[model samples]
Target: MDQPTRQRRGLLIVLSSPSGAGKSTIARMLLESDKDVTMSVSATTRPKRPGEVDDLDYHFVDDAGFDAMIDEGDFVEWAPVFGYRYGTPKAPVKDALREGRDILFDIDWQGTQQLEAAMGEDLVSIFILPPSMNELEHRLRSRGTDSDEVIADRMSRAASEISHWPEYEYVLVNRDMDQCVAQVRAIVAAERLKRTRRIGLVTFVRDLIGPAH
Candidate 1:
């Protein structure tokens, strides 16, 4: 006989890496390919960039609004970043998880630490690493998006970000995009099967096995 369907609680999937390490690219690929996983839109005081949609790209709010949410305990975790404040709202994430829809977070190591403290076992964290420092600098320059000074600043910050690799449960060296994405997908698949995540497994198995006879 076929097994009964077991219910599962959704996972909070987090991916962290320094700029130009292809973290954002991997995240985009995952969101595009996986129907069950969705990005966790954060609330931020920063102005929306070109082509960024409100609530989709980010829930852009003002300083006053951000402070009000902070005061009301609306955020799971929040921190000042670059001259602005950014945070993941508590309600939507919890709702999604209860509905068995996985949520993806693309945040820095500091934010990852905060989320780990707040969400604990619900979170699965991964860190992406550049193949080498030279390759990292090359990728940053190849973008042609920033001036030399900005690139230098990013390189300096990359060292600090990479130092937190030990904090993640999984680490991937992004030498090739396709392979890196495959590895991440495999991790997500395996994590979904973890015994703790499947809430209804005991009943499903008991039904399959029959009552002690």
Candidate 2:
């Protein structure tokens, strides 16, 4: 007989890293390889740009609409950036969680902290690090897009970001891109199998054992 499928609650996967640490590359690889995982679409007050679709590209709203959401406690985390407000809406996240669909967040430590506070049990936080400071600088320089001044600024900020590594549930050193991505995938797999996240396990085990007197 075919075994019954085990339902599980979805995961909120957060990936954080300093510039040149390969976090974005790892996130893109995971999304491309795993159909079940989707990127978190943030709601923003910024005006829609050319060719952007509503609710797909972003849940674009005006200042009053955004404020209403904030007043109604609709956002998990919100912040002002360059005169525009951006936030992760609670409704879609709750819906995804109930439907057992994973959401990926590419956010910084502060945002991760807010998410952890709001959804700690369902959240899996990972911090990616460069193999070394020298290697990080080399990677930045090799990009060939940034000026020497910009590279120095990034290197300075990288130190501050790396200091928050201890706050994450898992820390990975991006010595090789493929290895780092594999490690992240492994982490997601293990987290999905956690007993707390797997729903209906008690009944499944009980059925296997049969009814007791």
Candidate 3:
């Protein structure tokens, strides 16, 4: 007999890493390859830049609107960055979860912690680390977009960020980008198949046995 289809709950996949550690690249590849996952659009208080769509690029709101959301508990997690507030809105995320669609988050360790506190069971947090601090600095220098002073600052912050690797459910050393991406894909596959997430399994099994059993 053909097997019954199983419906699973969606996952909140979080990728956190220091600058130049390759988390962003991995996230891009995952989204490109997986139709079920999409990047999380953050609500921001920053003014919309030229050519940026309000809801597609970000949910742009004024300071008062953002403050109202915070007061009303409409955000899963939020933080101020360079004088502007950015946050994951709760409604879209909840809708995605109910529809069994995965959402990818590219945030820092602190935001990951807040998300975990809000939705621990649904979160699959991963931290990416460079193979070595020296390699990390090399990657930053190779970008050629920063001054020496900025590179030094990033290196300093990288140390602090790397210290939080223990907080994540998975930690990957990005020695090889392809290999790392494969590992992340594997993690997503396994997490999707977990028994707790497979909400339709009980019914599937019951239907398999039939009424005569």
Candidate ranking (TM-score, best to worst):
1, 3, 2
lDDT of 2 at 13: 99
Give the runs in model 2 whose Cα sits over 4 Å from its true position: 1-5, 45-54, 60-66, 80-85, 147-149
lDDT of 3 by residue, 152-193 (tens): 998999999899999999999999999999999999999999
Model 1 steric clash pairs: none
TM-score of candidate 3 against the unseen true structure = 0.90
| Candidate models: Cα lDDT each | 0.92, 0.90, 0.92
Model 3: which residue pairs collide? none
What is the C-alpha local distance difference test score of candidate 3? 0.92
Evaluated at residue 203, the lDDT of candidate 1 is 79
> CA RMSD for every model?
1.5, 2.7, 2.2
Best by TM-score: 1
Output the better candidate (2/3) by TM-score: 3
Q: TM-score for all predictions?
A: 0.95, 0.86, 0.90
Instruction: Give the per-residue lDDT digits (tens) of candidate 1, residues 81-121.
Output: 76788999999989988988899999888789989998889
Tens-place lDDT digits, model 2, residues 1-213: 213335899999999999888888899999999999999988999989899999987899999999999999999988765468888999989999999999999877877888999999999999999999999999999989999998998898889889999999999999999999899999999999898988867667778778791
